[model samples]
Target chain A: DQQVKQNSPSLSVQEGRISILNCDYTNSMFDYFLWYKKYPAEGPTFLISISSIKDKNEDGRFTVFLNKSAKHLSLHIVPSQPGDSAVYFCAANPGNTPLVFGKGTRLSVIA
Target chain B: NAGVTQTPKFRILKIGQSMTLQCAQDMNHNYMYWYRQDPGMGLKLIYYSVGAGITDKGEVPNGYNVSRSTTEDFPLRLELAAPSQTSVYFCASSYRRETGNEQFFGPGTRLTVL
Candidate 1:
């Protein structure tokens, strides 16, 4: 069974608008969640993360909100830009273990 | 620092052939990992090591092997390549600290088996 899931295979948004990507997990043991962004032919890069203890974390135009009770998390990108187009992967782990990654959501920001 | 790097960015192997994917890190990290991403699928852990001389299996360890003899290098070997083994391989390194175990990744190696 998949511990982490990203139901949407892709999403598109207009530049300067808000883009929301969602993720869900079935593993309750997961205490830490993270988002990674990847471009074609490139490795994934760390974006943002949230601990189960907190409900939200933000960095500049990117914000990650976690609803532990719902086993759901969403990544919000405000003023989305063309540069933000890429594949976004949601990952989670139970503290120090290896992370379990979701299938990924391809985000396209149109200019 | 170069962070994490993988060699032979792309490769094609015939059935029954064997090859090794090289991974190296310049950050002197204690934790190193190898993951494979199949088409339309998330990355799956194949193997990992916490330190030199200590290696462990991950979610998908079949048809693959790994060794970490030094802090800077971790190599994964595939024996008798098969079509199912075709995928993009990624190498990552990280320090086990309070920084959320954020990992640094290499560009990745794409392998195709015929």
Candidate 2:
């Protein structure tokens, strides 16, 4: 069974618009969640992360919202740029354990 | 610092061939991980090491082996490669396993087993 899930396979948004990517997890033990972005032929890079203690965290144009009760999380990128186009992966970690990742969502920003 | 480095950006192997994927990090991290990603799939952990001489298996460890003799190097070995082992493999390292210690990744190695 997949502990973490990204139901959407792809998302598209126009430049300067808001792009929202959603993820869900079945295991409540997960306390730390992170997002990684990957370009073709390259390794994934850390984008943002949120802890269970807070409901929301924002960094510039990027914001991550976590709904603990619903076991759901979403990443929002405002004024999305074409450079933001990439595969986005959601990962969850339970304390010191290795993270469980969800199938990625490919995001495309149309210029 | 070369945060992390992996050898042979791409490779092709026959059914019974064997090879080693090399990984090294200059960050002096204590935690290192190996992951494989199939097309349209999330990365799957194959093995990890918390420190030199301390290695453990992760979600998918079959058909692969790893060794960490020093803080800077970790290599993965594939014996008798099979088609199922074909995927892009990544090497990552982190300072430690704190709640949110982000991992640094190396350029992946793409392997094709026929």
Candidate 3:
């Protein structure tokens, strides 16, 4: 069974618009959530992270909102740019354990 | 620093063949991991090492083995390759096991078992 799940396989957004990617998890043991972005043939890069204690974390144009009660989290990118196009993965870890990654959601920002 | 490096960016193996995938990190991290990503699937942990001389299994350990002889090197061995083993493999390392600790990853090695 998948502990982390990204229901959407892909999402498209126009430049200067907002892009929202959602992720859900089944394991309640997960306390730390992270988002990673990857370009074709390249390793995934860390984007942003949020602890279970916080409901939201923001960095520049990227913001991550967590709803622990709903077992869901979403990533929001405001003023999306073409450079933001890539595959995004949501991962969860239980502090001392390894991270469980979701299938991933491909984001395409049209110029 | 080179952060993390993996060798043989691409490899093709025949049935019953065996090979080792090499990984090295210059960050001197104690937490090293090996994960495999199949088509349209998320990365699944294959093996991990807490430090030199200590290795353990992860979510998927069958048909694979690993050794961490030094802090910089962690190699994964696949015995009797099968078609099911074809996937892109990733190696990652982190400074410590804590919440929100980012794991640095290698470019990845694409392995095909024919």
What TM-score does candidate 2 reach? 0.97
Clashing pairs in 2: none
* lDDT tens per residue, model 2, A28-108: 988789999999999999999999888998989899999999999999999899999999999997778677889999999
Superposed by TM-score, candidate 3 places the C-alpha of residue B9 at a distance from the truth, in angstroms, of 0.5
Provide the TM-score of chain B versus the true chain B for each model in turn: 0.98, 0.97, 0.96
User: What are the per-residue Cα lDDT tens digits for candidate 2 across B50-106?
Assistant: 899999999999999999999999999999999999999999998755448688899
How does chain B of model 1 score on TM-score?
A: 0.98
Candidate 2 predicts chain B with a TM-score of 0.97
Question: CA shift at B50, candidate 3, in angstroms?
Answer: 1.1
The TM-score measured for candidate 1 stands at 0.97
User: Would you list the clashing residue pairs of candidate 3?
Assistant: none
lDDT of 3 by residue, A3-110 (tens): 899999999999999999999999888878999998888888889999988999999999999999999999999989999999999999766767889999999999
The regions of model 2 sitting more than 4 angstroms off are: B97-99
For model 3, the stretches where C-alpha displacement exceeds 4 angstroms are: B97-99
Candidate 1 lDDT score at position B12: 98
* lDDT over C-alpha atoms for residue B39 of model 2: 93
Q: CA lDDT, every prediction?
A: 0.94, 0.94, 0.92
